[model samples]
Target: MPEFAISADPIFGTYALWVGTLLAIAGVILFVLGTLLKRDVSQVWLTYRGWLIMIPTLFGTVMLGRTASVLGVAALSVVSFKEFARATGLYKDWWHTCTVYLGIAGLAIATLLPDPTTGANGWHGLFRTMPVYVIALLMIIPVIRNKTDGQLQQVSLSIVGFAYMGWMFGHLGFLANSPHFHGYVAYLIFAVEINDIAAFTFGKAFGKHQLRSNVSPSKTVEGALGALAVAMALPWVLHFSFPHFGTTELILTGLIVGIGGQLGDLTLSFIKRDLGVKDMGQSIPGHGGFLDRVDSLIIVGPLFFHMDRWFHGI
Candidate 1:
C-alpha cells in the first residue's frame, strides 16, 4: 500500500484565500456591469450592484493582512474623501483638498510602520501626526485669505474634511493592527454588509413603516427590524463554526456592528441629502464613488475594533 501525504496547511487558510479571490473577481464583474449598464439601468440599481461587488473586494483584501491591504484602503480613502469634499463644495479651494491628501498620505505611512503593540497606539500616532501637519498647513491659510471672502469657512471646511475622511478611514489601519486582528477584517465586512442587505431586502419586500423618509427614502421600520434579525443571527452561525469567538462575544459584536453599520449608511445619506447630490462621484460606475461604497465600514470599523478589544481582549 502506498502512503498518503496530507497538506500541512489547515482548511481555514484555503477557505480564506478562496473567499478573497472570489471577492476580487466579483468586484471586476461589477465594475464591468456598471460600465455596460450605465445608460440601460437606473443609478440606484447600478449603485447597489456596484457596492455589492466592491465591499467584498476590500473586505477580502483587508483580511489578507498584508501591506498591500493597507495601501489599498488608504488609496480608497483618499479618493472617497476627495469625492465627498468636492460634492460638499468644501474643496473649492484646491489647496485645502491638497492639504487633506497630504495629511492622509502621512497618516497612511505612519500606520504602515513595522510593529505596533496595540491598535489604539496606531490610532493615537495617526491622530497625533495628522493634526500637527494639518495645523502647519492651515497656517498658510491666513496668507491665502485674500483669495476667499469668508476665512472661517475655509478653515472650518479644511478641518472637517480631514477629520471626516482621513481620520475615519485611518481607523482601518488601527483595526488591522489589533492582536487578534487576524479575523477582524472578515468579521467587520460580514456584519456591515449583511446588515445592509437585510435592511434593503426586507424594506423592499415588507417595508410599510418609514424609518427616516426625508434622509433616506427607501429605509423603513420593517427593514430596520430585518437588519436586526440578520445581525443577531450572525453570532449563532459563528459560535459553532468558528471557535475563535464565543457566543457572548459574538452576540455583543453583532449588535455593535449591525447598529454602527446602519448608522454609517444613514449618516452618509444625510450628507448626500444635504448636498442635493444623487451620488458621491462617478469613480465606481454604479456605486457613485468609493465613499459611498465604504460608508458603513467607516462607521463600523472603529466601533467594532474598540468593542472587540474591550470584550474579546483583541
Candidate 2:
C-alpha cells in the first residue's frame, strides 16, 4: 500500500471527505439558524472556524506520510507542554521546563528511530522507557543545582510535564509506525473530537446534575454518559477503519475512547482547578489552548496504542 499519499489509503480519504462534508453541512445549518431565527451563535461560529483550520491541518499532516505525522504530533506535544508549564508556573523555572522540553524531544526521536533489535521503523522499547529516564533526570536536577528549597514542587511539576504531556501524548505519534496508521490515527482523532462534541451537546440539552462540581462546574453526568454512548458506538460505526479488529478489540476500543477520554479530560480539569485557572491558554480561538484540545488524547492514545499492540503487535 502507498504510505505517503492521502489517496493511497481509501479509509483515510473517505473519512476525511465525510468529515469535510459534515462540517460544511454544520456551517450551513448554523448560518440558517442565525439568519432566519436571529439567534446568536458567534461563539459556536468561532469554534466551527477553529475546526475548519484544525481538521485540514491534521489531515494534511497525516497525508504527508509517517515522518510528517510523527513530527506534527511531537510538535503538538511540545506546544501542549508549553501551555501546561506556563499555566502551572513551571515556566519560571527554566531548568525544570527545559528538561521537560528535552524529554519531549527525546520521545519524538524515539518514535522516529528504528528498533535496534529488529530494525523495525520505531524504537518501541525506548519509547516505552523514556519516562523512566526523564523522571530520573528530573529528580537529579535539584541535586545538580545543590538546592533543596522548592525542589520538590519543581521536580514534581517537571515529572508531570514530561510524563503526561510528553510521553502520554507521544503514543499518538508512535501510532504512525504501524502499518494501519492511516486508519488508526485518523479514527482516534476523529472519534475523540466527536466525543467532546457529544458531551457538550448532551450537556446543553439534558444536563441536570454536575459531573464534577469541584473540578469542572460546567460538565454534567448526562453529558458524560451521552458522550460515552457515542464513543462506544463509534467503533462499530467506523469498523471499516479497522477491519482486522474482532469483537474483543472493538469493545476495548470503545472503552478506551469512551471512558478513558473523559477520564483524561477530568484529569486536566483537576489540574486546572488546583492551579486556579480556567483555561490553560488562549492559543486556539475557541478551544482554550492546545492542551485543552488534546487533553483527551493524553489518556486515550496510550490506551488505544497498547490495545492495538496487544492484539496486532504493532
Candidate 3:
C-alpha cells in the first residue's frame, strides 16, 4: 500500500510531499517575482492553478486504485484528442470525430474492461494492433462518403488524431498493470513537469542559442542540455518510490523523457504552425488547452511505458 500511502498522508516520501511542497514553493516564488515585475500575482498564479487542478485528478485517481487510474488516463486521452480535433477543424466532421471518440473509448475499454487474455486488465496484444485496425476503419469510412473534396485531408487527420492520442496515451493507462505503477506513473508525470520547468528556467538564465528558432523560438540548446542533465539526475532522488528501477534504467528513462518532451513540444508547434493558429484553445486561461499542457506527456507516456515494459517485463 506504499502507493496508496501518498494519498493517505501529505508528507509521505517524495510523492505527495514533493507535489505539495513544490506547488507551495512555486506559488510563493511566482507571487514574489510577479510583485517585483509589477504584474498580477493571480495572472502569474494561473500556471500554478493548472497544476492545482491536474495533480489531484491525476494522482488521486491513481491512488484510488488501478480502475480509477486507467479511467483517468483514458479520459485525458479523449479530451486531448478533442482539442486536437478542434484545432484542425476535424470536429466539424462529426462522423470522423465519432470514430476517434469510439477508438479512444475502445482503447480504454480494452484496458479496463474484462478480457480473455488479461482477465480484468488490459490486453496488450490488442493495443499493439489497434492502430492498424483503426487506421483501416478511418480510411474505409471516408470512402463510404464518396466525397473527394477533403477526402484525403480528413482521413489523414482522423488517422493522426486517433493514432497519436489514443494509441500513445493508451500506454499510460496500461501502466497501471506494471509492477510498481504507483512509482512509475508518478515519476513520469512529476519528472516531465520538472523537465519543463528546468528547460524554461535554464533557457531564461543561460539561453543564447535557439534550439529550434523556427519551431519553438524560446527553446535553447543550453536549456535543453540543462533540462536533460537535471532530469537524468532527478530520478535518483525519487528512486525509493521505484526501488526495482536500476541506476541504468532510471538514467535511460530520464533521457527518454527529456528528449521525448522536446519532440512532443515541437510536434505541437508543427501542428499549430500548420493550422495557422496561435494557441490550440483557451480552455485553461493562460495555458492554452488540455492538449497544449499535455503534449510532452503524450509522447513520454508510450516511450517510458515501452522501455519499462522491455526492461522489466510489464
Candidate 4:
C-alpha cells in the first residue's frame, strides 16, 4: 500500500469529493423545495449541516494517514459503545464497560502493525487470539469483584457488548490495514451510508407493506427492496476500486452490504423496541443520536469485510 497521503490515491479523493458534492446539491434542492412548500426546512438543514461536518471529518481522517484512520475508528467504537451502554443502562457496571472499551482499543491498536505477509500482521494471529483473552478476563472480573448477585447479567452483557461494538466495529477499522486501504476503506463505509438513504427514500415513495411492523414500523418492504437493489447494483459502478471483482463477485458484495446494512439497522431497532424507547440519543438535530445515525453501519463492517475477504481475499 502506498503511504497514507491525500494525493496518493486520486480515485479515492475523487469519489470522496463527489460524495460531499452530491450531498451539497441535494441539500440545496431540499432547501429550495421546502421553502416553496412553506414547510420547515430546519430539520433538513440540521441534517445537512451535520453531514457537512461529518463527511470531511470522516473522509479526511482516513485520508490523512493510516494510524489516524485506525484511531478514528477506535474513537467511533468507544463513543458508539458508550451510547449503547447508556441506552441499556449498562454503564452502571463501569468495570465491565471499561473492559469492553479496552478490548476495542486493543483491536484498533493491533491494526497499526505493518503487514509482513508471512507472519502476524496481527490480523490472523493476535487479533483472533486476543478475544479469547478478553473472554477469560471477563470471567475473572466477577471473581475479583466477588459479587455473585447479578453476575449472570453483567458478564453476559459485557461479553455481548464487546462482541457487538468492539468486535464488529473493529472489523471496520481493520479494513484500513488491507493492501487496498487507500480505496477500500472509504468505499466500504461510503456505500453503507448510501444504502441507508436509498432505503428511506424508497420507503417513503412506495412503502405500502411493512417489513417488520412490530420491530420497526417506519421501515417498509419497499425500502428494504430498494436497499437490496442499491446494494446489488452499486458495486458495478464502483468496480474501479477493485478491478478484480467480476460481475458475480460484485453482486454478492452488494447483497452483503445492502442486506447487511438493513439488518444492522433493524438489529438496533430490535434493541430499542425491547427497551420500549425510540431514538438511541438526541445528539443529532433531525437525526436521533450518533448511534441512530450509525445503526445501519454496525453489522455492515463485519458482513462486508468477511465477504470481501472470502471472495477477493482482501
The model with the greatest TM-score is 2
Q: Provide C-alpha RMSD values for all models, in order.
A: 6.5, 1.7, 2.7, 2.2
| TM agreement with the true structure for every prediction | 0.77, 0.95, 0.91, 0.91
Ranking by TM-score: 2, 4, 3, 1
Residue 159 miss distance in model 1 (angstroms): 2.3
User: What lDDT tens digits, residue by residue, belong to model 2 across residues 146-256?
Assistant: 999989998998888888989988999999999999999888988998999899999999999999998889999999999999998999999999999999999899989
- Clashing residue pairs in all predictions, respectively, total 1, 0, 0, 0
Candidate 2 regions off by >4 Å? 33-39
* Model 3's TM-score against the true structure: 0.91
Model 4: residues >4 Å from true position, as ranges?
A: 30-39, 114-122
Q: Tell me the lDDT of candidate 1.
A: 0.70
* Candidate 4 local lDDT, residue 91: 88
Could you say which candidate leads in lDDT? Answer: 2
Instruction: Give the TM-score comparing model 4 with the true structure, all chains together.
Output: 0.91
Q: What's model 2's overall lDDT?
A: 0.91
Per-residue lDDT value at 268 in model 3: 88
